[model samples]
Target: MKLNRRTVLSGLAAGSAVLAAPMVMAQGAPRVVVVGGGAGGATAARYIAKDSGGAVNVTLIEPTRQYYTCFFSNLYLGGVRDMDGLGHGYGTLAADYGINVVHDWAVGVDRDAKTVALASGATVPYDRLILSPGIDFKDGAVPGWDVSAQSAMPHAYKGGSQTELLKAQILAMPEGGRFAMVAPPNPYRCPPGPYERVSMVAHTLKEINPTAKILIVDPKANFSKQALFEEGWQKHYGGMIERIGPDFGGENVSVNPSEMTLDIDGVVEQVDVCNVIPAQKAGEIAHAAGITEGDWAPVNAADMSSKMDEAIHVLGDAAAQGDMPKSGFSANSQAKVCANAVLGALTDSRVFPAKFSNTCWSLIAPEDGVKVGASYEATEEKIASTGGFISETGEDEATRAQTYQESVGWYAAITSDMFG
Candidate 1:
């Protein structure tokens, strides 16, 4: 079956049991604890809670009271979206679905004891643990940069404050100033994120500081939707953006956040703003749980179960699942598959076949959006791609506008799917 948004929702509703009344917990119900309340965790928590019909106790551990999405954050940077529009609270999940939404940091995980230790000195025991802690920057991935320099050179990879800081810095740049972005290597969260960010930054600068220039110091030879993004950049922001690839020593780079300088292959240039997107790995709790292989936690393709522990499932950007890019759509898709498996394991629910789909939409200019997506199924080795589609370059204005509209609708649908 085609695993589109509507299909996913309908299939879930048909396969799972009806939603149980709030606070109706069965005696000795199995407890499921989910860490990181972003796309994967929140969706997983909501699905399990709603589907189990109070047959399982669900507790979601997220540090933030208001969860802001990393997706579409670039639109906020570009003034297309507001900051308030990006944040979502878990009140509905708590009051409506009867989930225990704990706003506390999950500092450590004891897989042996099936407990998660929080910063509040509380140990929350779980029969099943779902980790969707998202990506954390790999230390020393970008030379001369660390968390200490975030204020001066914000990564802005994470949502919320860092995004605000980066946009603020952009607005504060001097006229004709240079904005440099150090793109991360492959296997980072959101492959099109940096490019879309460049597009949004260019969009912002063209209005306020028309003479400002943008530089991309990219380590990779090619990037996601390269042809489409390059085409849009030339058509919209010509002569304002320059990219240096590995051939031009873009791979050998360093930054001085204090001085606001970017050094490319021994050539240092003054820059007004530097957005460093470093190589990323699974969040710290995954490592603490000893489930990570190298940088990411490997999971079984059928259920997103961690290779190290069957009781633990790793989802989203943190999991080294094959074929699927690290994206919010992908995470949300994986969450449904995982939720079905977890529901079956815990509550004896009817589990559907594991199918996944992802579509990444990027807004190059106002009402000009392009998308790439694929369908996948579980294989013995991984979640292998089966078929795909992409927005072709040189599409008509009407087509691009329609794509943009589709993206807007998707955002609304997904946020509702996640938060509600």
Candidate 2:
């Protein structure tokens, strides 16, 4: 019991052991819960699990077992891709990484408790929460249009079965018949998406029914890549696609799904197919979670951490981060930054600076594609674009063809990155 050098060393080692045990357990036991299995949530969940090496528990909450990319569904409609090609499941997320794949709706989020309430009546607690629930339509924004009428006039914005449904309606159009679209307002998911769908529909119609007309009643004066799309439509599907902007009464529009009539600019017309892309807001779960200020959840651009709740990170289309388009690529980029930040908070891991990028390619015709992209860096205020590129308006066929190929490669790569 004498205070010798050996005894003093033994006492110091015991003290160090008692202090280290709690820190080790705390680092290993952190839980991350992701609601929505789309680009942002899926990528974040996978990275947090895979990179952490089983040190953190990850759970993915998604309603659908099979997910389809909204990015390429237009190609599927135009016969450039297939439905099966667009479909991805959570099997890889579970099998390869030990993520808890919960195929249930995230009905509620208790921010105070840092827990998610699923439709199955179970609550999953989390040290960090990631919500990337995408977009939802504003109810009754268009007169005589709502979720109940989605079947009669499909938006096809969410991809999956809706894309298939819209394609079916387009295919069954009468020869020389009219196809009308009520394009969504600005700040919707994929700003160029509606125009791309028009191009794809025209591509299909050119093969089957050359005389068929596609009309777009758009609320916005200008759309993403407006000049490029307009030139392509004229060159490829001449006299087939007519987009009526706000000056032409695109703003004031109403649809009667039952009668198959579209009213634009105080003129009512009967159409063979009516596709209504309504004004949108963040998904309902964001509202349920009380994280949204208006239509979108505000977040710290550097890490995608919610301003309303630091425990939650809002991403993808649900997040209101400036200068980043709400595309799959942007979501995936944000997710990686978020994963690093979350892991750092949980396990004291190294967190890198956030750099994000996105490129959206629209196929005008088979083998002809155009793209717009930008590289962004996290700033104190927002994720600001530093550099960007876009395909030229009059690019040669070979150049356009290469862009299309690049898109195909991107699709394959991103899908693998997200699911696997």
Candidate 3:
């Protein structure tokens, strides 16, 4: 579907009207504070502000003035996309959507006072708080790997500088040089992201250095879209990429940045460039707020409210919900459900049952894209899938081409839903 200005405005109006009618003007409209302005946080802020119709005061705290999506970063690496295309501004969120966007990092959460303390020494109080700060890497998960070492071996998972670093390394690699990737364990952000990175880098390598090879050292035996990715890699990239799972001693156990080598099962593998995606957990803010246990924050799936604190809700990668991959699309879906639930609680309206949907696209080549998606309904205690995985497997050429186009359409649709 084409997403023009008219369509986006219409969708926003309809979504707001439908969700707002139930909570017209009760208890003076609660002050909703949203942390982070990435996919999940931005979507929640926009929807809540629009639905409240100037009743609820919505404040969104994000450190960055703009956002660069990790979803299409591979395309950027492959030279098919540019920075301008991936970067998004938040002007519409402030002006058209009536959201108060604050550019600051949240340092602490005063749950008792119902306020979020910023590093700037400002404390913003909220009647309800939504936290979606995404993931943080677990230090010491990969020995000898840290922020400083990232200059030599980057993990482009967070986008921005790391992405540019990886790009430069690829361009500088000599013919027949090896590009090694240390894939993360399961339950990380974007299950198909690493594979997509390999594909995109391989595409660039095919042109710049035809003999350059890509080696993926993964701890897990299987990954998302395994067969499809393998097929596409072999068919188009001509066996330039090789994946090493645990069975093949492919686990990225450690790293030695000084020597530019990665230790895989006691064997030191040297490479021209390295990308390490380490194990991750909820952002530091969540942990500091006493909202997370272990690597994730536990929450009530029905409304995404924190199990420990009722007034606070956590969504996106920060929250630990079974059966939902930590993806931008999944986070966006969860944000709407949480927003609706928060509106109902504040206005004393009948809360409608929540349903969620997500679709993740991985491009193996310029013209080839594969995806897996599902639809889910929230249960008494958990969110359960109403439908199973819809694969792009066996799709004909015409169908594949259409799906690729649809993927682009989805990007526009989702970005509009989040910020426009």
The backbone clash count of each candidate, in order, is 0, 0, 0
Candidate 3 global lDDT: 0.85
Runs in model 1 deviating more than 4 A are 1-22
Tens-place lDDT per residue, model 1, 101-149, is: 9999999988888899999999999999999999999999888999999
What is the descending lDDT order?
Answer: 1, 2, 3
TM-score between model 2 and native: 0.93
The better-scoring model by lDDT among 1 and 2 is 1
Tell me which residue pairs clash in candidate 3. none
Per-residue lDDT for 1-420 in model 3, tens only?
Answer: 999988766765776433332223345557899998878999998888776666677889999887988878888899888867888888888766667789999999999989999999999999999999999999887888988899998999986767888999999998799999999997899999999899999999998899999999999999999988888888889879988899977764788887889888888889999998898999888998998878999888888988889999999999987678889999999999998899887766557788888889888888687889898887767777877675556677676677778889998889888887
Best by lDDT: 1
> What are the lDDT scores of the predictions, listed in order?
0.94, 0.89, 0.85
Worst 10 residues of 3 by lDDT: 16-25
Instruction: Provide the RMSD of all predictions against the true structure, rounded to 1 decimal.
Output: 6.4, 8.0, 5.5
Model 1: per-residue Cα lDDT at residue 390: 91
TM-score of each predicted structure versus truth:
0.95, 0.93, 0.92
Report how far off residue 300 is in candidate 3 (Å).
Answer: 1.1
